[model samples]
Target: MSTIVALSTPPGSGALSVVRLSGTNALKILKRLTSTLDFTPRTATLTKLHHPDSNDLIDEVIVTFFEAPHSLTGEDVVEISCHGSPSVVRQVIDASRNLGATLAGPGEFSLRALSNGKMNLAQAEAIRDLIAARTETAAKQAARQATGELSKRLAEFKTRLLDVIVVLESAVEFVEDDLPPTQTNQIKEWLLFVLSGVGALAESYQSGHLLRDGIQVAITGKPNVGKSSLFNSLMERDRAIVTAVPGTTRDTLSETIDVGGIPVVLTDTAGLRQTTDDVESLGIERAYRALNEADVVLLVVDGSVNADWHEAGLNSFDHKTQVVVNKIDLVQYGHSDLPQGILVSAKTGEGLDDLRAAILGAFRGSAIQADGLLVTNARHHEHLQQAKIEIKEALVALDEHRSEEMILAPLHNALRYLGEITGETTTEAILSQIFATFCIGK
Candidate 1:
């Protein structure tokens, strides 16, 4: 691989900046750029950077070197820690490039590490996700996966699949040589075991995705229904405009909050109402769109007013809806009549706890155990779905007493699909697509 270099830190001023270089020429290039040439590998040295062409001192920086095969990319690596000034970072990068190192592309270093067996494909993806994580829970989940929990489990499953494949192949190869017929029941049992195990992993993606991307909760209600007030209350901030006027809020405002460690995106949308004003109508249209796209809908209703089931606005939503009766302090309402709905006063903060509990209940419902492994990425979800289909096909072939050779194709396909998630069987095109989402130098 050609020597590649990039700025590892974000593009801005900070306490320190890191310029990374990897590949065969990393050590040689470092020697050419710095005055301290005799520094030991894996040791940090304070040295003066020299201009390659003029041999003049440019900056005094701390440089660290990692010998090949032990470094992040499994190649000779050099990291120069210098002042975070943009000009200083640019000068160092330019000096390295002039010394014959090519600029590193997005995720090139991590890609190199994967190519060299330092880490698997899944770990590489986890690192990327960790870097881009927007919430603490998302970061923790990515960190867990990056630490190889998922990889280790997948490896064990792969071992079991391989064992089954070996047995099946042996049965097919020796059948004509007085070999006893393969026991159909044993094979069925093995297939079921593998299928069930994989199915569990595949099903985990539902909760994983929700944790990673967060659930979108849209507040929808008629004008003057306390939608804005409830939105602010849920977010615990004055993010939305609260006014006594009916049509005060005519746009959607959004904020993210952590609810029981799960990120929830709460959107305070324009009040739903029939209005002839052009701008108000546009806002109402957007409100409907937000309601359609949301994962959960909070239908805020004024408790002081009677329920209006005949409103056409309520008919638009077909999702899991939670009816939140706001301004409950004004009424002597009890929880008995409304078993499923929650009553709260956004003004006085009355019954907000029940509202939050109900919100959490509507989404998770205490059924999803936190200890279960979850798949978070759509790509992984799709691959698992494909693998499930392949396994089912293999099972059907076995049930029909088809030849063992007929089952091998689907079995192999299933293995391949599972392998794709861990990057055991991957292509450059797919790898490029995956890594391209990362920032440069990761």
Candidate 2:
């Protein structure tokens, strides 16, 4: 394999910058660039870096080395830490390339690690997710996945499927001969067990996708219904313009927030009304789009104003709606006397806890488990669906007493699909697609 080199740190000035190299010749190339003789793996050695052609001192740096199969890419590796100057970084990269090291591609280090069996595909993908995570909960979940929690679960499921496949294949091979075989009932039970287990995992991707991507929440209501005020309250900042005049928010304003350990992208949309103004009309059009796409909709109603709830089309939001009665303090309304909808006063911060509780309740009431295993990647979700279909086909074949060879084909296809998740069985096209999403130098 060719020696690959790249800037391990983000492109910018910082206290320090790291340039990484990995391959069989990594140590050889490093020996030529530095005068220091005491370089060792896992130990930071202060050394002087020099330009290869001029033998001129570039900077005093720290060099660390890892022997083949012990490093990140299962090859000899070197990391040079130098002062974070753009010129210094560029010079170091140029010197390394001159010494026979090729520039590393995006995620090349992690890709090599995966290819060498140091980490599975799921863990590799998790590393990228953990780095890009925007919320505390997202980071925690991604970290857990990177640590092999998801891989371990998937491995367990694969093992069960393999056991079932072995028995089914044995039945096919011996049914024509006089060799004794397991009973049909036992076979049926095994098939059902595998099916149920895979089915549960397939179902988990729904919540997993939401956790990774965040839930879309829309704040919508009529003019001057405290929509902007409630949006600011939820965000705990003055992100939107608040005014007593109606239709102040003539466009959608969006911000992301951590709601009960879940990432929620909240959109404060314009007040819905028939208006002649072009800008307000456009905002209203966008409001409807936001409503249709949102996972949850906060229908804000003014408690200070006597609103005709029936005329406001309150039920139009259907199951996704959470009616928020804002400005309760202005109406002298108490929590005990509150109506069925959540009560809150954006002005005085009254009953906001109830509104928060309602949001949490909506999430908890769904099929998602807070601590359960989640499949966050869309690629993995698609593969799981395919595997599920294959398992169903196998089940049908078994039930119909179809030829054993026929059932094994779909069973084998199902195994291959599961293998793709961990990259045990994958094509170059799929690997390219997965690694292409990673940032360079990762």
Best by lDDT: 2
Per-candidate RMSD vs. true structure?
3.1, 3.4
lDDT of 1: 0.83
Candidate 2, residues 1-442, lDDT tens digits: the string is: 9998889888889889999999888888888889876577888889888998999998899999998888888989999999998889888888999999999898889999998888989899999998878688778888999999988877876887787778767876778753134555666677677778777877887677767888888999898989999989988889999988998998889999887667788999999887899999999999998998988899888887667644555476778899888888887655555445888888788877788767757776455544767788888888888888988898798778787787789878988988998899989888988899887777
Best by TM-score: 1
Error of 2 at 372 (Å): 3.3
Error of 2 at 247 (Å): 4.8
Clash pairs, model 1 backbone: none
**Candidate 2 clashes between residue pairs 3 or more apart in a chain or in different chains:** none
Where is model 2 more than 4 Å wrong at Cα?
Answer: 51-59, 83-91, 98-100, 168-175, 178-186, 243-251, 273-288, 307-319, 333-340, 363-365
Candidate 1 lDDT at 354 equals 85
For each candidate, what is the lDDT?
0.83, 0.83
Error (Å) of candidate 1 at residue 131 is 2.2
